[model samples]
Target: MRGKYIALLVAAVLAAAAAGVGTAYVRQAGRPTAKTVLPTHEDMQSFVQTANDWITERQKTADLSLYMADTQNGWRSDGQNLFHTTDGGKSWDAAAPFYDGGAADFLDATHAFALAKAVHDEEALTGISVYATADSGKNWRHLALSGAPYFSAEGITRGVDGFSMASSSNGLLILAGDPAAGSHESVVFATKDGARSFTKQADSLRMPNGQNTLALADASHAYLFINGSAAPVFMLATTDGGKTWKEQDSGLSPRFTDVVPTYVPVRMAADARVAMLSVQNGTPAAGAKGKTETADARMRDVFYTLSPDGSVAGKLTELLTDLPLDAKSVSMPDAQTIYALSRAGGKPVLYRFQAQGGWKRVESATLPADALQLQFVSLSDGFVLQKDAVFVTTDGGKTWVKRPL
Candidate 1:
């Protein structure tokens, strides 16, 4: 973003803003271009921005409040970029080019790590690169993982599931595969020197009779959500740093008996509750749309608490069961609150669920189009991810402004 821009690119952003976020004139899909084509500075002029508008109103009353996302939802010429706001969600700014956003673990304002994709060819995902930043986005250090289990992009593009950083110097890096491929394989790596180096922990950690999803409680603790032949939300725990795994009786299997469905990977650290939506007798609403959910897709929002010991807290609370409209996109900000993005009457709608009242529509003036993910740091401030841009809501999902990414 530093060297490509000239005076002419400003005109292009103005034109893009007019045609709207969804219709960017210079949009290209799938990672960078094919390996055969060498990209140029001009090619990035469309997606890359000089910088975002500075936080319009700084809030000095609050002690440094920040919300951030290593946004990787959209098409990008320079891998994934990090966007953050210091004063709640009053405004946001692009922090740095953090590749493989799904694998990003932002420990705080100054420390982060991610598994960078070293594959130039979009066809074969053959290699991986480790990136760590200590002084925020100002600089990054490339780490060594000579024997790291590389990602496989056989056909469908699956990304790094997540990176769990318990502290500045310890973390877990996970890469998952397509769930539709009968059996799922994920590689887990553990690092003690802030990802400066890592040890391959799990190359083929059993997903026996089904697909698997990884839920990390921290660096050494991980929960495996086994779907398909197993019971719904059936899990296995690895407390000894992913060396071995064993099934645990979560004790909530009886609650999800009716959830004849698929699994949605929940990426939260210890003590964080995640809402997993299960489509009863139908495919998962997220990636599977036109498969079998033609009739009413009865969905349920179930919350699970991940313990520090890498086990589901055994308290599975079912909320919003058999709703006509699925919280197709579900996020549990806390144990008591949930935010969901679903289509109502063929248009996207945001709903907030509370223990006090139930699901209620949140009226937002500027939430445009469909959102890919929702990240709410508090009850009031949050970030919504779209394909091309990120929208920030400072007033409890009522209004939003576009942030540069």
Candidate 2:
């Protein structure tokens, strides 16, 4: 897409006006109004200048530091400092500085948790300190962790591989891989009474273990996608916090001999009935010694599933089959909507997926070429992570607003 193109958030207002007029006509005339007129390509192009002008102004002043956003809040991190905004990206204030490397989960304006690795601890290679802030990012306190992901067998401590929080009282910490052993196993730790305590959910969870991710719909419902090897990818779900889990059958092929499949869980509805997955397939390439093969590859297709609320049983249907080979990311906020980013003809392109509709190209202002990470607070509210900053869209992807850190 070209930066000169105009966006069509105007359609949002048009749709609402049509709905109101249609309702009034039906009530007065005892019949529905005619179908609303669709805007022509010329009409859409008329918006190009307006969008280009806004983008030009933003580019002149963009700081390119904002890293995360939700419906009501935003977060930014420079190399050593972290900042936060609560009034929908109007302004931001510095929160705290992280020395080495860390990850944080901000549930809302008042509650947040951060994990930072110790810089000078030589004996404990993976030593981490947990910090919690309750005064809306103004103050922070160190919280004690009951147990961390340390393994006696390997004699090496493992830092947090992933972190997520559903509420002030519920969270999950995932630890995978070994610095010394190169293992493909994952262990899940759950917290119920805030960060006061943590416990291993069960036995060590075995997965295909390339890159795994967790999606928590709430304190109760969540899904875990483990990118399997040559075997079937594991799609695990939990309904009662992390106490129990069930491996979901994706209804795809049990195994693929021609192409190795990797599954990325995109989104799980709050009801847990609607879910989306991105499937990546690649031919195995011979390793250095020809004794093993690697399946590092790009995405091939996008699929979605729908079942009863909170149940893992569902039917998998392939949605977009004709994506660019360089398509690297997909995010679904709901069952019927998706935003996929990829490269086309050596340039970046973004696509939108809808239920019953295969895929449509989004031709607004161009997104950053390195845009990859996507987070959606709802079907309409979402954020995309670019190389340096976060771009947010409140009306799906029709238009985006930038908040530079």
Candidate 3:
């Protein structure tokens, strides 16, 4: 009944747009007017409520505006209603037309995208429905997959794992399916017209641990880093728009018998030229014997640089190995400064690395974890998005202030 109610409310908004009743065709952010359906506050009364006891859930935020999955009537359902807050997670507005599930790439404050994919019985793939919000989720427009397949192969459950958008009109979606034990393979699809349409790519990645992270530098270049099922750091690079992908050697290959690196991906990022990756390295699995939990092994977290096209470019650099296992890459504001976030003990801690100096405990953020991504548009201007709070920093990572959600 909750799903039906949400669906009816969305339909009513569309109906109003059709009848030209209460609507705003104002061209914001160079948005096309033909398919725009502006959602009103009253039309989405279900989104805003007096701050209740229900715990808010977190997803990737679209720019600074947070996209949340809040329960209807303080009760969880099959699908939680999507809501957005532009004012530092203060008052949320209903982004009802857009579902809050699946992989999302919130490009900026105005443009965001997601794949509202459908699966059956948690096994069989069902549909590929893509949606985009050009006006920051104020209005979401449905995009045609045109004829994109729901599943790249026969599988019971398929999920949109990630989105890498190089620009407003060019992007890629990776779907993980064909689960085995707990891991699955990945299928690729892309769009060139701001997701107006989509087409599946010929290339797919079949790794033991599947894809770890995908970053598209441009329309022609993309990099996929795996959890190194075969090596300490395994990577694939595509130069021909993913029509072909080739393995990249990191020069740190581990021997199966003499040497095997136990790798745990901490965080990684890449541009068109160089890729930055950090991994938590346990003792050499092949020869560790009984020294697997040695202090030296626990402190072997490393930072590496490689060519974005899949070649080793720089020597291995080690970071503060004491970082939490869930430490995520924050930003590379400059060549000498780096930032990372670790959700250790359910709390977020920020760390900064300075070249020639070392890593420093910047600030133990008060915000909660399960935060999708911490982004910095500039050197001092950065944001830490929580479920119901936003942490803003202006002096690099030295201090932070929380904002209401």
Top lDDT model: 2
Lowest lDDT 10-residue stretch of candidate 2: 1-10
RMSD of 2: 14.7
lDDT of 3 by residue, 69-136 (tens): 22111111113455555554445565645464545555555666665654333444466667877775
Model 1 residue pairs with clashes: none
Give the range where candidate 1 is weakest over 10 consecutive residues by summed lDDT: 1-10
Tens-digit lDDT track of model 1 for 134-213: 77556879863432244333433254544555677866665555654345666667778877777778776545434334
* lDDT (Cα, 0-100) at 378 in candidate 2: 67
Ranking by lDDT: 2, 1, 3
Model 1 lDDT, residue 284, Cα = 17
**Candidate 3 colliding pairs, count:** 6
TM-score comparison, 2 vs 3, better candidate: 3
Worst 10 residues of 3 by lDDT: 8-17
Question: Each model's TM-score, in the order given?
Answer: 0.59, 0.63, 0.63
Spell out the clash pairs found in candidate 2: 6-48
Could you tell me the TM-score of candidate 3? 0.63
**Where does candidate 1 stray beyond 4 Å?**
1-102, 118-127, 147-162, 174-188, 200-204, 208-213, 226-234, 248-260, 265-270, 282-296, 306-328, 403-405
lDDT of each: 0.47, 0.49, 0.46
Q: Which scores better on lDDT, 1 or 2?
A: 2
lDDT by residue for model 2 over 1-405, one digit each (tens)?
Answer: 000000110001001001001011001111114543333435323333332332243333222333333576766544356677777655768787642335566555567677776534556445556677877678877754423443444534355545667677877776664533334556667888777767777436555433345656667666665542323445677777666767776545421122223444444445334444433222222342311322212224535453422344543344333222111255555556667766565466767777687678877674655553455556677666665556778776667887653
